[model samples]
Target chain A: MKSQGGDPDEELVVRVGRGDPAAIQALMARKLPRMLQLARRMLDDAIEAEDVTQELFLRAWKQAPSWQPGVARFDTWLHRVAVNLCYDRLRRRRETLMAEPPEQADLGPAPDRGLQARDTGRRVEAALAALPDRQREAVVLCHYQELSNIDAAALMSVSVEALESLLSRARRALRAALADMRE
Target chain B: MGMMDRTRFEALAEAFGGRIDLWPDAEREAAWRFVAEQGETARALLADAASLDEQLQELRPPQPSAALRQAILDAAPRLRAGRSRLWRWLTGAGLGAGLAAACAAGVLAGAVSTGPSADATADALMAASDDGAALGPVESLGSVDTESNS
Candidate 1:
């Protein structure tokens, strides 16, 4: 679904369509980091994330020239593309690794438990990585990407109630997985 | 806005975390009102959820590498001079042949009119031809329909 109005990226996108060098550079500066982070969190693989980022830009360059404003915000469109690319890669991984079980978060107590910031961070990332795709996506979009719940729901093609349910379940699992950290 | 009950407030806290700002727009005011009425109780309800939110905050987003930035910037589409129908036709009919045809036309026009000398006309045509040559790659890139997946 398209955004209502006041898309901040609209002018830059139109300039990009015209192959404006300054606009392209500006857009990269603004969007690359966000897209990269999104891909990294979604895939949990840095190399694959970079690949997805490259592919996302290639599509953006193609879409720019023909882009129609108000149909959908440029940022929303880019997120959709990035999300779909991640899904494709995830699907491929599942197909090839069908015999292997999905990685589970190590919820067991750690022997050398250091509640250092870095260790806590790693544990959180692991917990996130261990979530099912839909739950992880819901958390990433609403929490990490900071997209509005409505926008995230539309992106996931789920109702807002369904999105809320996913978020609740994801948070519950994460809280359980990292329960040891709180103590 | 309806008054937020304890059950509803707890549910929102679970879904959106402890921060009222993260709650859905429709629910935030009511949620805040509930907090105002039952401060410590509301805070207690959100404490666990807030702890998880804090843990999630530990994983900062990674910065993009310089190499990836350079690669994507290098592949960006470049600006080219506008391609009119006549110019499109010229380029469509092979660059060398197109320049030759344009040069011949320029010579004929120069000979017939009281304009610049044929040498000057040919020089101008050659310059335009060189410009088009410089933009060939950009033009080709623009013409490609990426939707085909070829």
Candidate 2:
């Protein structure tokens, strides 16, 4: 657990093992916003988003004892957790929608970007969100999480070909969403 | 849907991926040709898929929050501290229980001994006392007669 600082993530993790408060603070200072951002996008509610983000890190901190090098990268694990939490929140929203047909689905903070960028990003999110949860997940891991297609497909618990099909549909959906250009 | 042939799909996917935003025109065009030859269905699907991919490419990864990085670092130590506390409690309980068990067993054996109770108790005590010595916790039968015979 010596802080050789050779690897940033590893070094911080080592510091954390040594009970360094600074490392913990340093970690939060870095990851909280992105976690929150991811949470917000997935949940579409800032408060719940923030909550998920906090919970993700809290679990991460609590699991440091058995932290190992090769299982999955810590960041990847956190992103996975965030993704799962988002799904959980989405399920609840679906239930709520079913229960009260009049209530609107609160799609979270719309990303602020250029006209093309914003439109494309939203179209993609909507397209992705429309797919079956697993397929959507495959697309999210590959495109949003920046995981390799193989890795994303594996994470979705599906064959790579199945994942490619999912990706194909996700792409088709996005094109439909954007290319249609109808209100 | 079921996959196309593995090799064909791989080749198509490989070609399709190469044109991802910025790649050499010839390579990308070649990849496009491979896709088109796969049939109209493939071409149409990929055109749509590629456009959507181009759209998705717009949703950039945002700059992570200051809080996020800190949360990660903070969580690691907090988890370690929690585990550390649990371990301390477990080790302390184990040591205490082991000592209590040993005392109970020694007393029971001593009290319930045959005619040579005191000698047996002395031997057991010596064994426990020398637990951390050079021999490292081996019980000695203390039979010189046996050694000499050997």
Candidate 3:
């Protein structure tokens, strides 16, 4: 993955701490989509994803004032926050089986190859959501979010070797679940 | 380093993707060597993983709604402002009695100001104070009494 140079959000976070509106806009543009993607993939629900994203930003606003710079990249910290929030919801889901079933996934219609892609995508998502939470988190972080193994491990708070183990298991499960996708 | 073997190579392909470039640097050369020596078998393993990768790629998130973005942007300032405003309100309530006590004890000078803002603030502060006697003098001094003046 390409580096974006030094932390761009350091100064913006300071400004956001002071409640600068432009800083909020800048942060949103830079962070919101990726956060939304992580949340949606983790929760497999758009509404919950939106709530998690909103709650994440609300936290950023609250934390900005006391934010200590250089400890970590703001983006990494934000992703960690998103993952934690998703875990909380996932835990709640397990505790109370009555949580609304995951929203109906809409695989948009596109021509031929696009249609196949959508069908495969839907299957992949269902298989992903079916995995145990930790395994699902490992795959989402490394595969979908494209975090390098090292960073993904750090975010998941596991040793690098442990992360690879998780990835291996996740892939095995996915490969089995998605076997039908193969000709 | 030992020559890359099929089982380990397959595991690498499964754990990462078909793309040797994405494999960890330490393993990439070994993986490449394995692919070179066992071209068809290596390719087959990678092809399986690549199929999964392709579907993973297809799992693109729906385009985030404009409203969601706007709502988040709109919310940032409000959460911040709301927090600070709540702090001010809480401080006023908690300190209402202390402030009144200070005025009664003659620890601080009192300023009498008239306006809707002062009236509302005084009413809130007075409401929050537990001791009516201590607040009596403070209110008499700060109360804007807009109702009669208006």
Candidate 4:
């Protein structure tokens, strides 16, 4: 379905297109955190995620001048760019066959026997990181980013039904992996 | 829309958690109706899914570090005062005029550059102003050195 009108970033983007310094700052404030979170979750690496976010904004500045509104929402378009960059990094990692494995979350019993709130959060992060790439993307987009199924599916270039399948598998695996947290 | 069947309701709850609001727009009304009709059974079906959602919420997103924010802001596009005025006038004149003006600014910037670093900054600006030229690498433009323009 077509996204409804009135993208909040529309006016600010136009200003940025014209090289308005204040608008540039405002767009950074509004979008930086979101882009960071999306990258951090998708890549499961803080440093690499920051790199992706920076690159995303650089591209944003270039695209702004030629930006055609009413074609697609700016935020959605940004998400697509961020997602593609993450995919590129992932592909590179696979091609290189990096010596160190991706970090694994400690799923064993909590050392304290009772998990702290912080520990629970860590465990969840580990579980999420452990998910397959596409599954992780599905969960991150739908559960964390809270993009609509339609938007997320479109960004992933999959049908809505396929996106649901990814979500179901991801959530089920998470439910199993973090089962003790529920207790 | 017809009321959601129990099977479909369970499937959606499993995939999208227990929040009807998060369900696809097309299914929300049916899901709500099913909830109203099913009552306890609906709550029972949602219990595990809701618990999972609650646990998932525990994973908070990391905050962007100040250094990262500053680095990104540093790389952002800047419009030099002189160039902005020139661009406005040229654009008002026409496309051909704009292109000619951009070439003039490139010449002026290059003339002002005496050192390698200064030359690189001029090159970056030229690329930025030229719609046809692809953007240079992010590292090259990270610090635009706007003082040179002044």
Candidate 5:
């Protein structure tokens, strides 16, 4: 609903790519928080998710100097990094169906909010994590990442058609997974 | 339109992409055109499709982690170190190799000087000449009595 990763953001990315530290800070100020949130959703573990976010930003800083335009959006690249890292962690899991972080690591407590939005948010997070990896990434990019379909498709390295399919399956899976939870 | 199978419905679902909610003008016009002329069958399909789009939008993602903000920031230094360390090691290795090559050259030079080669032979000849007696005949030959006989 709001403007995100738009033209001005692209200019920031281009500046950062030119070896500007201030640009890095600016980029962090804008993108880091959202990147962290997205990573958390994908990884389902706050600490690891944060690591992914940091890694993603660090990569952007390192890669900024040589970034080329017309390939994809900067935010798309960041989301791709976050999602790919999640998949890597998922594949490396041993003796665990999911990444069950200890309760101590529970991202502290959530901010106080209305029960409906908060509960819906919680169920949504769990449902997202429960999804098969790709579907989760697809849905996260579509809904939470708030990327355009074309950009999301580019990030996923798939055609628009393929992305459509991914989103479709993802939505269906989410609906099925959260069936018991009343939205 | 009448009774598309699950696969066709899934295809429609994928194509629609919940665009019904957004109502992009061209797409809406196209959908309208298709639904307008067609019988009740097409209308029914469009209606079902619209409902599906609403359902898709209802599935929401949650708020990210509480510590997630901190976690990402904390990792920045480590990531920086990772990138910087690589260049540091490369530079250090390059300097080390250069020093190693210089030491190797010094050792080779030392060996050559101490070696029993033609240089030692030349040194021996120079020492004989230094004593002056070894060059006595040759030196006098330049000032021989041939000048007095002429």
Candidate 6:
């Protein structure tokens, strides 16, 4: 029986709990893209993002059997795990680059997009990388991953107003950083 | 909700960017009302908000490589199997070791309960040693008393 705001993954998680391989595959298919997107945006490293995403699923497999339904949405739990993993890596990274700028992922180019578009994309990436860690995280969760502000706030373990303030500051900084591009 | 004045309107735009629809539902109506009443001024603010949002689109996350996908798929079943195997190994080893310990304890208990006493065995060993000493040396096994040997 579905509750008022039941997770659609409840049934799939149940099946996964039963050791269903197909269910694992289905869950991966459903979750991997967004998880990968979140990690890539947050970490800016394809390999590390893949590592985080892969680990997320591995943990999902381990947790499925004991997963309690209706406690929290599986997707939410999964995102929390992902964001925490990103934070762990970020913390480790901060030690080495205390004064240096955050490293950018080697995004290269898309064949379909023109040179100008590629240049704008690179500038955007650089600007995003230049953001303060918490602000960047808020933007990634809210704008890039398209999570609701409420959910993003929950994931960040901050109040909604705090989350909004983070987003506001992040947007302002981004606009200022990219102001030259608009002209 | 009160009518969206200039300060509130700009704050909303700054917080939520240009997308009026993307604003939280609680403020959406007031935002829309403000946008409708203020006309070009509000529209200009929205335009400013949309600028960064537009550039952000250029930073689209790249699709995961095919190799990465395959690697994850390959790892999934292995990880699953590894968990089960580890569980089985731990439990199996524990049970096996426990059963072996129990059997050893049983055998020891059985020996203590049903077999000759330690004192008797020690005395018998001492007597045999005494007999061997009386027989002079181990090199003269044939010289042992036949009746004693019997």
Put the candidates in lDDT order, highest first: 1, 4, 6, 3, 5, 2
Instruction: Flag regions of model 5 displaced more than 4 Å.
Output: A1-8, A18-22, A69-72, A94-118, A180-183, B1-29, B32-150
Off by over 4 Å in 1: A99-118, B82-150
For model 5, how big is the CA root-mean-square deviation?
22.4
Candidate 6 Cα misplacement greater than 4 A, ranges: A1-4, A98-118, B77-150
Instruction: State residue A161's C-alpha deviation in candidate 4, in Å.
Output: 0.6
What is the TM-score (0 to 1) of chain A in model 4? 0.87
Q: TM-scores for chain A, candidates in order?
A: 0.88, 0.71, 0.81, 0.87, 0.71, 0.84
Candidates 2 and 3 compared by lDDT, better number: 3
lDDT of 1 at A91: 91
Which scores better on TM-score, 3 or 4?
A: 4
Model 4: residues >4 Å from true position, as ranges?
A1-3, A98-118, B80-150
List DockQ for all candidates: 0.30, 0.15, 0.18, 0.30, 0.05, 0.15
Candidate 4 docking band: acceptable
Clashing pairs in 5: A17-A64, A17-A65
Q: Write the residue-wise lDDT of candidate 3 on B1-150 in tens digits.
A: 568999999888888877878776678888888989999999999998888788678787756787677666555643232222223333345545445345433411232343346556555545444322211221122322211111
What CAPRI class is candidate 3? incorrect
**Candidate 6 chain B TM?**
0.48
Error at A62, model 6, angstroms = 1.5
- TM-score (all chains, Cα) for each model: 0.77, 0.53, 0.66, 0.74, 0.52, 0.68
Least well predicted 10-residue stretch by lDDT in candidate 4 chain B = B141-150
Clash count, predicted structure 2 = 29
On residues A150-177, what C-alpha lDDT tens digit does candidate 2 reach at each position?
Answer: 5565556677667767765655555566
Docking level of model 1: acceptable
Q: Candidate 1: TM-score? A: 0.77
Q: List model 5 lDDT by residue over B2-103, tens digit each.
A: 433435443544544434443323344545455465547555665654554454455443344545444433323211111122222333455454454465
Worst 10 residues of 6 chain A by lDDT: A106-115
